[model samples]
Target: MNDLVVQTDGLTKRYGERLAVDSVSMTVRRGEVYGFLGPNGAGKTTTLRMMLGLIRPSAGTVSVLGRPAGRPDVITRVGALVEGPGFFPYLSGRDNLRTMARYRNLGDHAVDAALARVDLTDRAGDRFKAYSLGMKQRLGVASALLGDPELIVLDEPTNGLDPAGMADMRALVVSLARGGQTVLLSSHLLTEVQEICDRVGVINGGRLLREARVDELRGEATLRVRAAPEEAAIAVAMRVAGENSVRRTPLGLELDLSADAAPALVRDLVAAGVDVHEVSPTERSLEEVFFEMTAEAPTTKEKVA
Candidate 1:
């Protein structure tokens, strides 16, 4: 349809001297899952608030589902779980859902179905005050799902969740997307972003760093060849890498690059008369990519800061 579910351009906000959210531009494709990832105080919450219209932007604009974000007309197609889902703490989880339904005018079955979706039906009757942190989080998710929204935005849904709860949250998010729901999720957990997000926008210090598909962000095909006689392997590695980091291991030196690039590096090694053996990549994890991209050692960011 060439339509975007969420989009922003130069969407900025500030409070006096502090720019809470820098000029940020982002887009969520009509039917794709997009994750917003950043560290604490990276302006994630501020940006999200702007997107949802909870607060007015100091400058810039936001559009959701083609309408101005937070416009009354947009709420029907959009659901949200922001800042851990504030609910009536005095009400039972069941009552909380029931109250929300009253306003949506959703059928009685809708609440039960939503609770079942999160596997919190058994705990529905528990008072919000008495529920564990994870249970509360689940209830919030149930609330967001009540209206069968096409686009759902969640912020830190796994906060204080135990491992099992986190797993459940992940399953629900993926299941929602599979069911044709578009989700915009924000989280500080890099692993969660890598797991459930199809694409991600990395934010740092109130700025957008990059956005790419999960696979592209991780990069494919780096082979680590650990061979003995470190000095000899490096002589060959130098020709291909020149500046890439090469660590000395007891077995050999590790070569970091794409698998396709591996052939060129290998060819360089052969041309340099170095024998290569035992090549493998250290496990591929988002953590590795995160560290590699955001490494604080030194870069343009620091140069400007």
Candidate 2:
């Protein structure tokens, strides 16, 4: 079996005068959650469409499951919920899944299993029009889960979800990966992506800026310390963390040293007659890093508005 679930080589898409997606290449590995992140109109949706063979790329190519994207055999092995769910409002959620299942030649058991996976079984009998935005999103996910595809592509899957609902969605994604399935997730929720995705591809201004592991993108963790007598604290931090390794921030002094060095640093601070107030390990948030990477790129129309 191919380790790469999805791969694109110089994928490009043009919309008349506008370049919707520039030359881009990305890969999604098997059994891992790959986060596709970007601001609105940053070509994320366009790239996804090309991958699904919903739209032909103006240039380049996309491969799914080691074959050309959109091949019948390859597409049947992949499930996707993009843009938004479109189902008959009059139909109950269960009926909606059943309809889709039948079209795919799947059985009723698959419908039930999908509904249960997304925790929509209790509301399966409710009409689609009566469901909340979050409920509708979950129902869409259930529809995608039908047939138990090897790879699932979800675009903003947690949109409109409450905190609890979001947590449940995160767990569901994690569970999917654990069960030997790959997920290609496009989300604006950087914090959520950081928590769940193994690696991420960040795009900006119709260009892919970076592709890396979550930790690699965030960089190394650092030690943050707050102590009385600011001058004394700075001296101690420099000596303990090595010269030029400490920087002053509004929060406190941040050192390049690891958390394991916290004990010795604290002891040194105390020995220097400094009153220690707080000491904790800190890591950069994905949101912070995202802004820095895209700061130089032009803002998309959605962001400008």
Candidate 3:
């Protein structure tokens, strides 16, 4: 049996003369959170649509749980929230969940269980239209969980959430993964993705630039040093690490060197009579890496057919 719960091979989507998703391939292993990251209009939604069998790919294939995409059995094992949650505004949250459960041939007990999982049992009786945006998002998640699916695909799940709501969603995702469900999360929020995803695929201009573990894609560690005699400190850093290895930051000088190199660098700065106040190694955030990767990607003109 394949270890991967989701796999896409050369998935491509074209709208007339325009290529919306170009040869995108990705994999999501069982019991992991795989982030699909890209800016708005960078084919994230398009790719997701194809994965959920909402739209057919122009080329390539998608397999879910070892079965081809769009197969009824395979789809039943997957739950997804693409675009946003849609339900009858007049209906109560519980009624909406019940309605969805009926459509999926699920029992009323499934609705209750899903609501409890999302901590919405208390508010499940409220009208969908009266629920806050965060509440609605949670309802969407609850609906997805109604089938007790093995794989969950969420696109920008936290888009309308406030900070607290975002935090709650993150915690819920982590909890789900810990409970052994595989999750495919698509979003442009780098920090959120970095925090939750075990691995991430960076996409831009309808093309996937790279896919790597979160730690691997974080890039290199840099030394952040605050010292007096800024000019002297910079010179010393450049001499020790090389001219291209040093740069100025608002707090101090940042050296493009590993944490292991920090000791030698500090000694060199101190010996040079530079009053070093602090020296610490800092890991590059996902945002920095995202910008670096996307900026280096070949520019393309927007085309629509």
Candidate 4:
């Protein structure tokens, strides 16, 4: 079987004078969570909609599960929640699922299984209107799972969630991926994307700036050292790593060297008679990368330990 569950080629969308999404192309491998990350109005949602066939692209093509996206057979294999889910307010959660299942030609057992997968069985009897926002989101996920979809596309699933709710959502997404499900998660939250996505496609101003594994995009790790005679410590770091690679920080000196070099760097500083209080590895946060990619101005690297 092909490993790629989703693929887009030159996916572009225009709104008369405005270019909503500029010639974007991306791929999502099977069984991995792919985060579509971008700030507001960056066209993350638009691209997702195009992928799901909710909207036609001005130019480009999309394929889902090895078939042209938007075809009935292809749509059946993929599930999506583009915007906030809308359920019949008068119906109970279970009833709502049952109704949707009926539309999908699914049996009651399918409804039960979907509810169980999302941990909504306990509150399945509660009216949709009475369910909490988090519960409602989970129900939406349950509905998406009704068809036992091979691919799930979610657009900002944590949009209105509180801290705890966001945590729950994260766990849910991770659990789904662990179950061998492919997921395309669209979000503007850098932390959430970094925490849950194995790979990410960063978009800005309707343009895709980069696509890379989360670990690769994290860049090189820096050794953060807190030592007395900071100048001598910095000098040692500059000697070990290039001078341009060493930067001063409020905490101490930061050397843009791999974590494996920490011991050697520390030994050099200590041999130089510097009082080494601490040595820790610090990696660039997703937020830093996001800002650096999106901002027009040159970004100054900040120490983060």
Candidate 5:
């Protein structure tokens, strides 16, 4: 079987005068949680729509499960919840699933299994209109989980969730991946994506900026140092980490050197008559990296997997 569950080649979408999704090529491997990250209006939803065949792309192609996306064969093997859940308000949560299952010619056991997977079994008898926002989201996920699809796509699954609800949703997604499901999740929640996704594709201004494992996207770890006699400390940092690798920040001088070099850096600082106040290691968080990428103009594409 192919390792890739989803692949898009130069996927692009335009809206008359506005470009919704620019040329984007990305891949999602089977059994990994792939995060589609971007800000509002950055085209995360647009790209996902194209992949699910919910909307036609202006240009480019989407292949799901090694076949053209949206075909009956492919769609049956993939499940998704985009924009939000829509169920009959008058129907109980259990009935809603039953109704949907009937449409798909699925059995009652499937509906029961779906509700259980989303932890909605406790509220399965409650009316859909009475469910909270988080419950509704989970019910939407339950619907997607029907029929045991191989790939699941969730768009902003924690959009309106409280902190606790968000944590629950994260745990659910992690559990899904552990159960051998490929998930392509789209969200603006940097911390959630960092905590759950194995790989991420960053999009901004309708274009894909970079796609790689979360760690790779964050780049390397750096040594942070604060010392008196700033000029001398900077000189020492430049010599140790190269002039181009040394930069100033509110935290102090950041050198593109690993934490293992802390002793060497401290020694150099002291020899240069610099009074080192602090020396620690820090790495840029996903939030910081996201801001930096979105702030810049679209650059050459990074490695995509």
Candidate 6:
């Protein structure tokens, strides 16, 4: 069996003369949090819709849990909260979950447990209209977790959440993945995605730009070392990292060289008699990696703003 819970090949979706999603190929591994990252209107929501069969792709294919997508049984092994999950404002949170379960034919099993998972157990009986935006969102998430399906697709799950609410949602997502559920989570929050996602597929202009595991990315090494006496250290950094690779950093001259070249770097530094204070890997955050991997041109709006 394929290790991927969700796979799309050359997934294309166009609206009239406009292309919303263009030949987007992405995968979500069976037990990993795969972040579908892009800016607003970069086709993230459209992509999720296609995966959930809410919208069909104009071209290409989608598969979920070894079964073909767009099939009647596709939803059987999937639970998704697309965009903001729409629910009846009149119904109580518990009633809403019950309705969803009944519609999905799950028949009253662990409804309260799902509610408790989202920290909505006490408010389960509160009318949806009376619930705050965060509370309603939590309820929607609770509904999605009802079936405990193998795959869950969430689009901008933390969109309206405040700081504490965002923290709560983050924990909930991590818990879902830990429970052996594959998540195709779409978010524009690079920092948060970097923290939680095992792998990420970055999108720009409706196309997949990069796919990398966190470890694979972390393995792309650079070193940050401080030299007690500055000039000798700079010269050593230049030799080890090459003249173009050395940069003056806040601490000292930074070496943008492979981690494997550390011995040569240290030897050069030692020969120069530069007191090396700390030699460690420079951890590049996902946002920095995203900037490096994408196009150089700034957004039109960024220029305007």
Q: What is the C-alpha lDDT of each candidate?
A: 0.80, 0.92, 0.89, 0.86, 0.90, 0.80
lDDT of 2 by residue, 217-286 (tens): 9999999988999899999998888888999999989999888989998999999999999999999999
Model 5 TM? 0.90
Model 6, 151-228: lDDT tens per residue?
888877887778998898898889889989888888888888988999988776677777889667655667888776
Residue-level lDDT for 181 in candidate 6: 89
TM-score (all chains, Cα) for each model: 0.84, 0.94, 0.89, 0.91, 0.90, 0.86
Better of 1 and 5 by TM-score: 5
Candidate 1 residue spans exceeding 4 A from truth: 230-251, 256-277, 291-305
Pairs in steric clash, model 5 = none
Error of 3 at 277 (Å): 3.0
Which one is best on TM-score? 2
Candidate 4 has an lDDT of 0.86
Error of 5 at 229 (Å): 3.3
Query: Which residue pairs in candidate 6 collide?
Result: none
User: Clashing pairs in model 2?
Assistant: none
Q: Could you tell me the lDDT of residue 150 within candidate 2?
A: 93
Name the better of 2 and 3 by lDDT: 2
* Residue-level lDDT tens digits of model 4 in 214-261: 988988788898998988888888899998988888877888888899
- Choose the strongest candidate by lDDT: 2
* Candidate 3 accuracy as lDDT: 0.89
Q: Model 6: what TM-score?
A: 0.86
lDDT of model 3, residue 116: 94
Comparison by lDDT, 5 against 6, better one = 5
